[model samples]
Target: MSDQSSDAVPAQWSAPTAPGGDPIEKASGENFPVALRLLPPRIREDLRALYRYARHVDDLGDEWAGDRLSALDRIEADVRGLYEERREPTDPVVAALASTIARRRLPADPLLRLIEANRWDQQVTRYETFDDLLAYCRLSANPVGELVLHIFGRATPERIALSDRVCTALQLLEHWQDVAEDYRRGRVYLPQEDLRRFGVAEEDLARPTATSQLRALIAFETRRAEAWLDAGAALVAGLSGRARLAVSGYIAGGRAAAAALRRSDYDPLSRVPKPTSRQIASAWIRSVIRGWG
Candidate 1:
């Protein structure tokens, strides 16, 4: 367990240590772009609020070295503060997020779902089937897009449905990339049925190199992710202006991550694949000009 002094310090939420003196510096640590520079300042701040909320909850679940569940309990209280006029937003991240929630008239459901996802993480580690995995994604990933759409004033039922597919695909892409590391954490995101089908046993994940069977299974999952991604492509085509660009970035990110898996030939245990900067840039441009589909 980490020492109390360190655990008690909210260094991540403290006034930024960066020369710019903005906590936005922490945004760079995100897997996806939270606030693109080209976006309007107001829109960027809105996205940043969502990003910060997600990021802090993620840290409580994954990065916190001690007493994580207790920390989460405290965070839950602060989240309630956002809804109550009499309660103060005691946490910096929560306070900033409260502002966004107020400004956009965002629903509390998606944000609450995100917090619940991390709480679920405390008890659940492995999934039994693809459907089960998707259920987990509904909690862990889908809320992010739903919240973003709300921020952008684009959370129609149709768009939220497509966004779910995209978000779920992105989550799967990340899981495929982190298979080995996740295995080390005693958590396997891969569906057990798929593992059995491909003859890729759990022990294969602990190896320094991926077995042929493991490679095959990763390839299969990659294709499944691709299909989900393709299903959401229409989401980008349906939007305009900065919302269009933001969704385009998401589609391109999924493509780039999927490409990385292919480039590694699915040998994730040996070394996880990642898209090059050039590949990401190209995909972003293509997504803009050619559309996500």
Candidate 2:
């Protein structure tokens, strides 16, 4: 409902879909359902539109080969086109987002923040501290939860705070999972201070298997993420029906992914650990049951 961070929105232009995979499927794999069959048609379509917008931005940020900043700028212009100009957009994803923006009255800021996060990604490759990393999450991840709340008509200050915790935790988990892959791409999401504290060299992250020190560092980081995730799960109690189900899926997915990481002894360097279907189902059921309390 409000801008939680004071990130300046930049103006610029280029719209290229990140080349590789299906955006919806890619989003689904990241820990939550975009559009579930059981949701009402309107909500399902709305969620699909949101996912497309997110996927389009993420693909450009993560995979676009040329001038990513300008690409982000182009997308942001289209987003502003939807809200500010009230005109059709050249990019189909941003074009599709028009109705959802009108229907939900979603702010341009969150969409702009998503683009800002990617722009930050291009410039800031390594985080020097945990606090710095959280700032990045404000740009990169928390806005999605904020926008989701607006979509469900549940964006309140209290709920937004809780959602921020859940979103940031999920982002941290993703970074931990992609340590090796990120290193290869010339980025490191793990805070430099933590690496120094745990004696984990950047080179250690690129190893085929994690060193003992690296595993220890990951274990420590996983614990930090789970604490925030558990605290945020309390948000589910305040929600009901489909909104509760969707938020519960997010909590469950985060917990399940954390469990998977633990099962691998927090050695993400060996392989990117993922929650199995049973784990996801079990966590989701537990979350739903707990929410009934």
Candidate 3:
């Protein structure tokens, strides 16, 4: 996915979850399950704790209209508190993450990277090149996979590589789906070069429907994502038991989102594409029958 990870781990993760209430609702509001039923109860809290941090950071970055950088600075300070063994954290997200950090002995770097991604969001509204976008992913999406590997104790060199591929692919897919929404929010995730190459001006995205060039561009990006996703096939194939199934859901969800885009002729402006229940069930069933990476 990127050059950030030097020593990868084994690909053996499979799920995310949370207990009933505010955190759980926010966690479930995510596209993929943050705390899924397939994972163990012990894994659920830690996974949601991580998601709680990410979700809050994302809100401050993308949704808040105020001084996001200043708010994020506070978040960074609390992240340090988690590692410093502070008796208590005022922020509930950091408070929840404390035990998980101590229990797993997780590095603070991955969590900080996520925060850094949001910090970049405050300064960057558009990416000029594909490489530049990938650089953002290195800070934004890839850290979640890295954190997950660390949680599973499988942050080996090989697994990190595979996780990087999967996380980046998913991040790209999210950008594709949010073309209309991101534009309205004063952000655009599509590379500027690609937009120029395809004759897709920013105005084209502001329209009620995708222009033909925009559709073609979306289709091309979707195919590109699928190819990138294939790099993680070995990851799905290598794991076993519940962990394997959990990882399979991630790929399945991405493929389903791609399918929705295809079904609409890649016209994301018409509607955002999401995975349906049947499609998600099929993904799990197929993995059960066919075997996971």
Each candidate structure's TM-score, on Cα atoms with residue i matched to residue i, is 0.89, 0.89, 0.88
Tens-place lDDT per residue, model 3, 3-43, is 21222211321122233553434431234632156689787
Please give the distance, in angstroms, between residue 62's alpha carbon in candidate 3 and its true position after superposition. Answer: 1.5
- lDDT by residue (tens digit), candidate 2, 131-180: 99999999888988888888899999999999999999998988888888
lDDT of 1 at 114: 79
**Candidate 2: regions farther than 4 A off:** 1-24, 33-37
Writing each residue's lDDT as its tens digit, candidate 1 over 91-189 gives: 777777887999988887787777888887888988999999999889889998888888888889999999999999988998999898888877899
10 residues in a row with least lDDT, candidate 1: 26-35
Q: Report the error of model 1 at residue 153, Å.
A: 1.1
Show model 3 residue runs off by greater than 4 Å.
Answer: 1-29, 33-35
By TM-score, is 2 or 3 better? 2
Q: Name the regions of candidate 1 deviating beyond 4 angstroms.
A: 1-35
Clashing residue pairs, candidate 2? 13-74
Ten residues in sequence with the least summed lDDT for candidate 2:
1-10
